[model samples]
Target: MLGIFGSARKTAAAMADTAYWQLIIDGVTSRLGPAEALCLPARGPSRNMWNWHSKRLHPYLPSLQEEFRRLAAYQAREAGYADPGQTRSMTAPGRGQFVVGDGAVPASPVRGPGSKTKSKKKHAREKKEPGSAESDGGSAATGGESPKVAEDEPQANPRRKDPGAGWHVEGGEEEDGGHRVFGPKFVLTSVRDDRPLSRIVLDVRYQRPGKGYGGEAALAVSMLMDAAARLPGLTGACWDGALREIHRDQLMKAGLLIVSPQHDGIAPRRIALVTGCPCGNRHDLWSKGGALREAESLDTGEIHLTPTTGSRLEPCGGRRHRWYLLTRLSCGNTHRERLDTTREDHRRGLNRTEHLRQHPPDTDSYIHCYRWRPDAESLNAQLDATLWNRRMIAYGAPQQTLVMLALAQNALTRHLHHRQAPSTTRQERAPP
Candidate 1:
């Protein structure tokens, strides 16, 4: 048992080697050719995997987990499963085990240190003893850690009550029926083909339910940006319900928006900078080519601004115009003034749900180019069945162990699929 464990550790260490990476790449090149682009499927844990103490001790575990993902994709591609433009279909007719009504992902909970709750008596006693040497300079003199703040900070969430664990949610509606998953979360992308292409780990993160979809989206977007850096033409992302309107706008603003059902909406109209105030009262207020003279949100604050191009200044409370924005019109007047947008700018854009309903990307012919997004649940099911049972066997940082588990799962499943294909085909031919 000791020898087996030691050997496993050594194997993990070798995963960081350049030669090992080249070997995997060489194998993939021989089998499938170079990888082009992919539709990534992201999955979070369904259960909790760590206590507050373990999380504190292994603060850097999440970073290590992300590194493992990059290595896994590189290795899988080398292993000949994730070649560019591979024709393998991940969701062929009988390939994925899809069930009714559970297509969407559920929400997960984040586990962090609980808020410090001290009794009223303790606070009173501390106040009365403020003059004590320990309360004054003892910590500094002894070089001890600073005293912890006792305020009742907000806890992770009341819904997440499990100790030594975090929550998990898949994408989609509330009826998705997801349970708690332990360990780290991973986003994977593989070629969509029947020959079983290699899967790449796009991103990984420590499950934080408190952040809701925000944290997960950030990590996934980061990975997408990295992949875009490597493959400039990379476009599109097939995600679950986690890709909300806010996330879509963020991706669009970053210039990475592509064809995805989740990203359906009328792209926001372009806005341009304007010079020369439309008030027609010659002044330097609009002449200065520096930053905009003033900026403020619409319908929120006391912004003395208007969209009308030119009007009698007397009736309008005799307000002196400072700056203005212009649009081309027959009157050559400023049609509108630019207003700063808040974080929740979706309200200002087209309705997302309606846009998707009218023109679904799934029905569109153009989207079939990037390969269908592999069912994330299929990978999750495989991981749960093979590796993440009731409890994880590997010890130490859960992130490191979970990452290795994911890589092994991806490798093993691809291998298993190949091994069973021949026998399954023979059985199909040998009908009764």
Candidate 2:
């Protein structure tokens, strides 16, 4: 809600009306959205629509975007708690329902932002020596005679202008399948559905790299924190490899299991080394190396060396050390010890998000929970389908957020209605 302050009084025309705001939102959602979605032809009256949008709608989008965020969050919250018996379409969530967090930087499909923001490719090209042939040819071409304008190679990114857009390149070298993606990214959080082709989007975030939002992983954790309580029986979070130790610890504290198939980095897969040691001095072995051996009345304690792959349950040769769970060690039959995070946090901080799960890639969980991560991509594809390149009818972070919220609201509304329609129909058809 926008607060109006100051003692100055104004006519109704100058005042903010919540009702007018709702009306404009509904109009834009129903007509303008369907029109622009998937590049569908926009069908509506011309004169009134333009006047209402330009005079009445455009100015208030910034505020309405926030309201729309509230609307979507509230609606998704209600949808999650809906009765399973009444809404047959709702996934019969179990004691430990899973949620997934994903993010994507949709190409802005515009040209200007990249020209101003992209410096990697430019810098890479600039690394050439100043006295090199390409530089000399450039100096010679600029002087005396008319400069020759060589036709440029086709641009990999599309062109249009949206303020605040940036260039983010993904993957490896260009020749080895690397490519440039230009735009602001959006992160989405959603509950996994057992019913095929069905998932409820809970929240969305519009972001740029290093903009205080803490990238995709941070945004995902923020969403899980908010959604954890509203969602009944939330026990595990399925995520990609981008999770960090701090973020993972946060979710682990909230009583959630993390399952990620990809490794976080080339770093070792151990979450944290088990505390206490056979040496009795209690020094922890962080890196892959030897266990220190100690003996009373000896000159210097001997060093018992071993590879990292040695059993965590027992030392290399000195004495046995009890590790909670060694690297890539399965929880085995009973996973209860891990359910209580207080018991595990101090001992592990390696690859688990335990929020940014740094599990070795292609692990078994990938077959079950992790596979559902693609549902997020499906949702993204649906949103992207509506984009022409990546430009939308709305622009800017706030405006982009509003578009995302609107689409999410529409999807939930339709799904909720479908979920409840059968029961409503049965009541009407009964002998009343």
Point out where model 1 deviates above 4 Å: 1-63, 66-69, 73-164, 175-193, 253-362, 366-371, 388-391, 394-406, 409-432
* lDDT over C-alpha atoms for residue 382 of model 1: 45
Q: Which ten-residue region of model 2 has the weakest summed lDDT?
A: 1-10
The estimated TM-scores of all candidates read 0.40, 0.54
lDDT (Cα atoms) of all candidates against the true structure: 0.39, 0.48
Q: Look at candidate 2 and tell me the lDDT of residue 117.
A: 41
Model 1 compared with the native: what TM-score? 0.40
Q: Evaluate model 2: give its TM-score.
A: 0.54
Models, CA RMSD each: 19.3, 13.2
lDDT of 2 by residue, 1-432 (tens): 111111112212223455544554565566668454445232323433433454455468657654554554454444443222332211122312567767766666466432544345455455878776555545555554423443433445544457645665444335546576667777787764455534666667776756366677787787787666555345456776556556666665654555654332343222233334333342223322111111123346654322233122211111211112233212222111121234445565433333223222343333455666677677777666655433444446655554565564345444554666567543312111
Tens-digit lDDT track of model 1 for 1-432: 111222233443443456654565555555556561122112211123223333453666656655655654443434443344543332221111111001211112233344345665446547856766656645647777546555644444555343424444554333656454433444444322344543444444443444745666665566555554443323335555455545544444443423344332343232333445465432211211111222224586653322222321110111221112233322355444322223333556533322321113443232443234444556555444434232333433353344333445444544554555666443211111
